[model samples]
Target: MQIPEVGEPAPGFTLPGTTVRDGARTDGEYALAAEIGRTVVLAFYPGDATPVCTAQLCSYQEELDDFGDLGAVVWGISPQALDSHAAFAHGSSLTFPLLSDPAGDVVRAYGLVAPGIGLRRSVFVIGPDGVVRWRHVGLVGLRFPKAATIRAQVEQLVA
Candidate 1:
């Protein structure tokens, strides 16, 4: 399946999952439809506890405030189980939500799932109106975008 493109409506999803560090089941269903009125940053990492994954997650944590100030909600999705996600988030002190997509249902919908591996490193920025505004698939040595890059894109949507 082709990845959703910019200006395309993000595929709606209500995935069952647990929180990053809290180990608590989030009450409300997580759906792109519900996030329509706000900017949503959906990031998919490989697995939990790996070196690259660790740095990627921690970077998102460190930039939480900046993302919040831009009025964007950030989320990380992986194929790990709830317990593992919880441990990783707790150890990293990540502020955003980390959800489990063990079945790869959500990941597949976003076209982030690799044939053999779980999820490809990718990030999609959804506009307030629910259209995908930006996306980046796997890079050899993927690095999270700098704060300025994030701010610029978000400002365009929020403006």
Candidate 2:
């Protein structure tokens, strides 16, 4: 499957997402259509709590304010269940939504599923009009764009 490219509508998804911030935990559905007028950073990782995945997500957390300041909503997607997602969110102190795609439907739609293993570490920067503006699908699970790079993409998309 081909990854959704710039100028293409992103594959819509309404997945279960949870976020805990400042001791308040909120759980709800995260739908792409709902973010139509905002920049959305859709990051698809392999799983929760793995060393590399943990580092990648924590890096996002460290720069969460930068993403928000750029007027972007970042959601971490993985094929893990909501239970795993909840645990990961709580343990990692991730303020951004972590979406659950246990059925792999959404990842498949985005053409992000890995060849023989789990989901490829992928990031899609969607613009305010709901079209994909930039994308990075890592060949391996461990490599991914840093928070600064992702913010730059969001800025470019909105510019």
Candidate 3:
């Protein structure tokens, strides 16, 4: 299936995740409607502990403040379980929420599933009104944006 086009409402998700900072397993229901008043960044990756994914996630973690300042909530999603997510969170010192979509529900909803792999590297920028404002599907052989580029996008969206 083709990727969800821009301007579409981001598919909502509610999945169980373990709180890394507190060591508590909890359900995180991330609905587009719930974030209607604030921008939401759903960064999907293939897996945790991998090099490319690590770099991508770390970049997101490093820019948490900028995103927050723009009134945006960022969530990292992968097929990994809560425990793996917890480890990835702790290992990378991630400050945002890392959601576990073990059953690929969210992935399929967003049409981000790679044919032979898992989740593809994609970023969905859901505007404050719950409409998708921007999306980038993988670096795809180009030197995709670093933290600065993403921050710029957030600033532009909130501006």
Candidate 4:
């Protein structure tokens, strides 16, 4: 499947995930369609607790308020199991949902499966209208866009 381009409707998906709510870990399903009417950030990473992935997500968490200020909610997707996601979210102090796509179904749907590496580090910003407003798919999986950059894209969606 091809990655959804800017101006195209983002591929909708629902996946079981872990979230930190009220200082507690909660398990639930996260559905993209349910987040309609709000900007959604879909972040696909390779694994849980990996150095680069850790840094990328931690940075996002730190700037989460900026995204929230724009009414954008961020969701992180990975092939790791729910247990791993829960532990990673706790260890990294991430408040966003960490979705588990163990089957790689959602990953493949987003065209983010990195042939031999599992999944590529990618971020897609979806507008309130369900259209993709911006995206960044890392070519080498060694770097990710900073939170400020993504926040700017979300800001545009709201503007």
Highest lDDT model number: 4
Point out the higher-scoring one by lDDT: 1 or 3.
1
Q: Which segments of candidate 4 are over 4 A away from where they belong?
A: 21-23
For candidate 3, give the lDDT: 0.76
Candidate 1 lDDT at 51 equals 93
lDDT, candidate 2, 11-54, per-residue tens: 88899888878857788998999988899998889989989899
Report model 3's TM-score to 2 decimal places: 0.87
The superposed Cα distance between candidate 4 and the true structure at residue 158, in angstroms, equals: 1.2
Candidate 1, residues 58-125: lDDT per residue as tens digits? 87778788888889998888888777877777777775777778888888898876766667888889
Better of 2 and 3 by lDDT: 2
1-159: candidate 3 lDDT, tens digit per residue: 457787877676676655455554454655557677898888888888888888888887888888888888888888898778878888877767788888898888887777667767888888887778888887441233576777777788867
What lDDT does the true structure give each of the candidates? Answer: 0.77, 0.87, 0.76, 0.92
Once superposed on the true structure, which residue ranges of model 1 sit more than 4 Å away at CA? 20-28, 139-144
lDDT of 1 at 43: 80
**TM-score for all models, in order of appearance:** 0.87, 0.95, 0.87, 0.97
- How many collisions between residues are there in candidate 3? 0
Q: What is the C-alpha RMSD of each candidate to the true structure, in Å?
A: 2.3, 1.2, 2.4, 0.9
lDDT of 3 at 90: 80
How high is the lDDT of residue 27 in model 3? 47
Instruction: Work out candidate 1's RMSD over C-alphas.
Output: 2.3
| Runs with alpha carbons beyond 4 Å of true place in candidate 2 | none
